[model samples]
Target: MPEDNHSTVTEFILTGFPGLHPEYQGLVSAVLFLVYVLTLTGNVTIVFLFATNRSLHKPMYYIILNLSICDILFSTTTLPKIISKYWFQSETISFTACFVQMYFVHYLGTVNSFILLLMAFDRYVAICHPLRYPIVLKKSTIQILSITAWVIAKTGPLMLVIRAYPLPYCASNIINHCYCDHIGITVLACTDRAPYGFPALVLAMFILLGSLAFIMFSYCSIIIAVLKIANVQGRIKTLSTCSTQLIIISLYYLPRCFVYLASNVGITFSPDLRIVIIMLYSLFPPMINPIIYCLRAKDMRESLWKQFNRRIFTQKAQVPSVSN
Candidate 1:
């Protein structure tokens, strides 16, 4: 297992859901396909709505626009290939594409994590300091925060790739998960792996725990501010608005914290179960995000409905009546 042996592995076979029954593969593939379509269409609609509607344009929404884009790109990176793996039995991904997917998977994930934190910050400002919120989170300020998040999120994944890309992969070429990620790819390397894996674990913890702490602080401040509102109805209104983001934040962070803890720490679990959880957290948020927005954000839903009606009416008008 010399370091020079990395060249021997040109592609990796993805062994998706290793414990799934053979008879259930089709069912699983069909279900994943439906999820993939729904995730793509829903996120795409959100991004389009943000782009087209001036009413939807604002700092909070600009943050949401980033989240929507991340959801779409992240799902695109993962689902189609995984669906094809189960459907067509196509599991081989070229070496370059594998790393490319790995890069985006982590990169977009980091971006989404920060976007959620930004949204939390936005809500905190708007709720706890409504008077100064506009002054503090002006368009210029929001632009800088968005750009900073993107730039910061980019670095960790590049560090991972730089450390992992050089490792010799003489050990194995089969990934026991649905997607390429730091652990999945680096575990294939023949080296001691601690040098790669440990740093990644630290980075993952830093991202998840750090963001969670900030979000909690923001929410705590928001809570205190909400309690100070003289009108009970106003307090309830404010809390209700945060319901969607709260649920989404839970989905995004909770599973990840468990996965990292169980995997990196001393917890023992079956390999298949671990992989399933990994895929679950990664896939669940993006799939549910659009639904959360539509259910929680009335303005986005109304704008989308208007757009949908316009398209339908225009289509009906364009259609020629049957002469038969």
Candidate 2:
């Protein structure tokens, strides 16, 4: 607990993909950069599409917008630094910067999880309690809940960083990852046991298991309601709306739960495998989210096409006017 009882380790050396052949660095960098670009573009497009379309002003689209924003921040938190590390062979991150990175990464990730849960709740209410859905999920209520989620998600990491400040950083400050991950940072801690460990575990439970349970419960109820519907069209309509959400939730949660549980259980894998899983966790959801929403939500697709055709027609009309 003594603040001065530790070694003064200034920066952590990141051993990303250690012992990999140097020739593959460029290839890895290129692949990571491409994934980062796609993540950014896809999430930004979703945010823009939601923001511009007045028809998407409901609670569901609001949650989608928040989710997209969280995705943008989440990807930015880890991938850019990872790409830079591979591309430039720069692996050193200052303690302050590392903590900041970890904070935002957890914050955005937790917020994203909660937002998805809220989306599930929204869908559940719409499906199960159609009459009260609008009143239950008013604009003010959505805003309040969204802000609360962000605040709660951010609080744990921030406090953990503060608590861990007292722990000494000895000479061994090598982080075996491309970015500042919680486990990587903890591995570098010189103390016998990090003070942040328990809090981090609690946060992980809340973010992953708690959210997962909520989502599953909501979906279970949704499934039962859909089954009870007598009309085929009604059942199909409800099922279709929930299907994309189910797919996205599975993709986002399953890998995360696996990785997190594995790390906690001391089942250490190779750093390269770790990197691959982390990259998969970071990149895939963002890339797939827009695709799922656009493809599954008929209204979103129509809106996108409407906007696209409007632009094309505007350009064509402008050409004729210019010629005249």
Candidate 3:
């Protein structure tokens, strides 16, 4: 296509699960709506609990708070539009809007990886050098690190937008994925896509593998430290503290690595199956993170219990005495 032909495309249609049978759209939409609701409620409740409770105002909980906020923002960014796509057949997104969504989808994803890295570092310090943990991860230090992660996450996505956004889009505007992302958007550029696609791939790998490498190392160190503890009960207690984070990290990193790596290799997936895999890694973690915290983190568990008990007591107190 000629350079002059590039600016003709102004909007994109998102085809959510392109291979889905027409009859299944209603079911898929319902399920996605339910997931969206749960994701918001769970993550929002975490934020509310953290804000209202003084006991959770600590370094670990502070990291969790950032993760919760990212999850809420992430789900909000990607979910509603897809739900609308499935329900109302409202698939058209303006050119500017698609890029904006693309920015946030990748930006928040990068932020999440960084947050998990922070979490792994937190556990590593707490376990590997228990004596220095408090001094090392003071409130001010944690706050600074979290802010840095948020700031740093902006680079890759901004570069993506800068590189890919202005490319001539004389090709089709129908995005095959559920939400706008770097690959989904750049593939539609009318020019040779390799120059654009390769850099984005490198950036994606840098974020995923860089964070995963550090996280793996941190957990390994934690494991070594736990093994050095002679007391069986002590080892178990220390390991329990990190169990939730381990699960969250796995949920976030494993399938993502698989998908990204698989794509680069010769492996191929049907468009619908690929999107399904993407959604599994993307949506499942945010919905499940709060549940993991409530079940695994002692402080969060205690706080939830206290709240539950207080609510019960208030209800009981409100009941009228019936005996004569």
Top of the candidates by lDDT: 3
Q: What is the C-alpha RMSD of each candidate to the true structure, in Å?
A: 2.3, 2.3, 1.5
In terms of TM-score, how similar is model 2 to the real structure?
0.92
Query: Candidates ranked by lDDT, best first?
Result: 3, 1, 2
State the lDDT at 182 in candidate 2. Answer: 79
Candidate 2 clashing pairs, residues 3+ apart or interchain: none
In order, what lDDT does every prediction score? 0.87, 0.81, 0.92
Lowest summed-lDDT stretch of 10 residues in model 3? 1-10
Error of 3 at 307 (Å): 1.3
Per-residue error for 145 in candidate 3, Å, reads 0.8
Candidate 1 local distance difference test against the native: 0.87
TM of each candidate vs. truth: 0.92, 0.92, 0.96
Model 1 ranges off by over 4 Å: 262-267, 315-324
| Per-prediction tally of clashes | 0, 0, 0
Give per-residue CA lDDT, model 2, range 142-221, as digits (tens): 98899888887877778777776657777588887777867778766766564567677877787788889989899999
